[model samples]
Target: MKLTELADLYRRMLLIRRAEERLQKLFADGQVPGFLHLSIGQEAVPVGVSSALSDRDTVSSNHRGHGHTLAKGVDLTGFFAEILGKATGLCKGRGGSMHVADLSKGMLGANGIVGAGLPITTGSALAHKMQRQGHVAAVYFGDGALAEGVLHECLNIAKLWSLPILFVCENNGWSEFSPTDRQLATNLEKLGKAFAMKYRSVDGNVIADVAAAAGKLVGPMRRYPAPAILECRTTRVRGHYEGDRQDYRDAGEIAALEARDPIRLAAEALAEAGAAPDLIAGIAAEVDAEIEAAAEAALAAPLPKSADILADVYTPAEV
Candidate 1:
């Protein structure tokens, strides 16, 4: 990647970090309405993967998907408003933190259920295949979703049909409060082979590694289309959700997580890759100001009115 591209990735990674950090404070102050699952330490996976995608391509994001949504070109102003439950939000405040989406940007939606995106993206990829649209579908899920039946089902279908889809596993190794390794019988590498799909695992903290892996798999789908799995070995620093004390984790282990922070790693990478210190510092300042202003606007935005509560409902209220 060129210096400009690398810098932009740095900016985006910083944006996700700052945005989530702001939400952390908001949720703590009782300003946010719903339970928040933050992807604080997993910015590189989304930033690197989303960079390899086009606007017309679709993304089906999992529950912990703020980074996914933002990296996929969702505006910060509307994103903050959506999480703040404002009427002007992308989903008109209906989706909130967990279900936030902007279909205009080809973000299918951020699902609340684990592994829900798997089938959604699979069907989307099938549509692209049948229609010959030459667009690839990307689904973002955590290692926790490995146990879900839908993961296998989707992979089988995708393989059978040669669907143009990318199964992105952000393996933080945790399923809510428990470790996923203890819960799952098989891992992603074996699962990839079981499904007869191409697979690559990379250090998820390094943005270049993720960008390269995703670029190879997702970008080529338009022509030499096929199903592939990219496992990002990332980390999750926060609790499963906001407000949990994480007493389950030892102090020493929790302290170690700070060292693995993606934001810091990305900055270091950029500097090592010949980016000047001023450029990197400027990017941070720019992202920080942007997040602060957007958060203020989202907070000041109007909440959903009680009278218009069911405006965008698909199913009948009687049901």
Candidate 2:
């Protein structure tokens, strides 16, 4: 990787890390509403996959998608404000953390329903194909969705039509306190083979590797327009949602999480690539300051009024 490219990846990963940490505190302090699912350890998957995509391409994300939203270039201040329920936020503060959408950025939105994004991108991929837009559509789902019927249905449809879509699965091996290995009968690669679609797997902690793999897959999908899968083996450093005790988790795995942390891995890679320790520290400090400022600004913003709630609502509240 070029020094500049490595630096960029390092910086983006650091941003996601700090942003999630800040949001966790906000959720704990009662500043954020609704349930919050965080993708703390799995930052590299979105940061890397999105690095290979263009602004025209669309991304549909699952519940644990704050990292994907930020990686897709959503405004940082607006993202924080959105979660904080500020009127200045994306979606006018209606979507909160789970439903953040910036259509202008091709962030189709994050869904609270598991595996909902699969079918969404399947349709969007068809739209891109019929329109000849040459832009791929991708979805970020977890191992929890691996067993969903929608995943199988969308895979069949996308492969049958040769839709330009990337099914990016961040398999952290757990499905809401239970091991996903115990939940699903087959893995994504095997599942892809069942549908006769292409599939690739990468170390999700390695941002550079995921980017290279995603570029190779997304590159062809842009031209020939075919469906493919990229399964990222990752780690979920936090419980399924905020405030959970995570008593079902393995103690050994919990202790080993710090070693496999994505941010730490990226920073170490930057050091091996000749980045000075001070330089890496400076990058982290810069991201921390940015996150703190964004958090403060978001907290200070005004909340959406109840009387004008229908203003941002596109469809009729009573159809």
Candidate 3:
């Protein structure tokens, strides 16, 4: 990749990192309502995969999906506003943190259900195939969702029809409070092979590695149009939700995960690739300012009007 492209990746990853950090603080301060899921240590998965996707391609996101949504080109202001429950949000504050969606950007919303995105992604890919649009669908889900029966059904159908879709499993080691190994006996690669689908596992913390793998896999899927699975071994720095006690986790696990922070890893790689220290610093400052302004705007934005509660709730019949 060119220097500019690498810089853009780093910038995107940094934006996710900083944005999540700020959200954690905001949630702690009681600014954000409801439970919040932060994809802090797992920035590379979305940044890498999204780098290979076009705006024409669609993506379905899981609950901890701010990074995925942002990487897929959703506006940061609207994202923050939605999380803040403001009227100007992507879903007019109705979707909150777990349901932000922007169809114009090909982001099909972040799902609250564990494995909901799997079938949604498959359906989108099927539509692309039937319409001959040549577009692919990428779905982001966690290790927890791996056991969901819908995932198996989606994979089976995707392979059966050779649909163009990417199933990205962000294996963050925990299925909520329990370790994933304790819940699911089968590994992702084996699961893919069982369904006769292509599979690849990459270190999810390294942004460059993720981008290259996703590009290689997704590029072929767009052309040949077959289902593929990319399992990214990642870390979930925050608890399952904001204010989670997290008594289930090991004492030093979070600290160790922080040591492998994706933003820091990407920044280091960018530096090794000859990006200037000053340039990296400038980008960080710019992202910080952008997020700060977005938060301020979201805080000042009005809440959804009570009188118009049913206005956008349902579709109307054609005249």
Tens-place lDDT per residue, model 2, 232-261, is 999998999999889998789988988988
TM-score for candidate 3, please give it: 0.98
lDDT over C-alpha atoms for residue 151 of model 1: 94
- Model 1 TM-score relative to the real fold: 0.97
Best TM-score among the predictions, by candidate number: 3
Instruction: For model 1, state the Cα shift of residue 225 in Å.
Output: 2.1
Full-model lDDT, candidate 2: 0.91
Error of 3 at 106 (Å): 0.5
Worst 10 residues of 3 by lDDT: 307-316
| Model 1 Cα lDDT, one tens digit per residue, 168-262 | 99999789999887898889999999988999999898898999999988877888679999999999999999987888777787788788888
Checking candidate 1 for backbone clashes, the offending pairs are none
Across 1-319, the per-residue lDDT of candidate 3 in tens digits comes to 6778889999999898888888888888998999799888899999999999989999999999999999999989999999999999999999999999999999999999999999999999999888776789999999999899999999999999999999999999999889999999898888988998899999999988899999999987766889889999998988898888888998788778877888888888888889989999999999999999988899899999988788866798889
Model 3 RMSD, rounded to 1 decimal:
1.0
Candidate 1 lDDT score at position 99: 94
- 276: Cα error in model 3, Å: 1.3
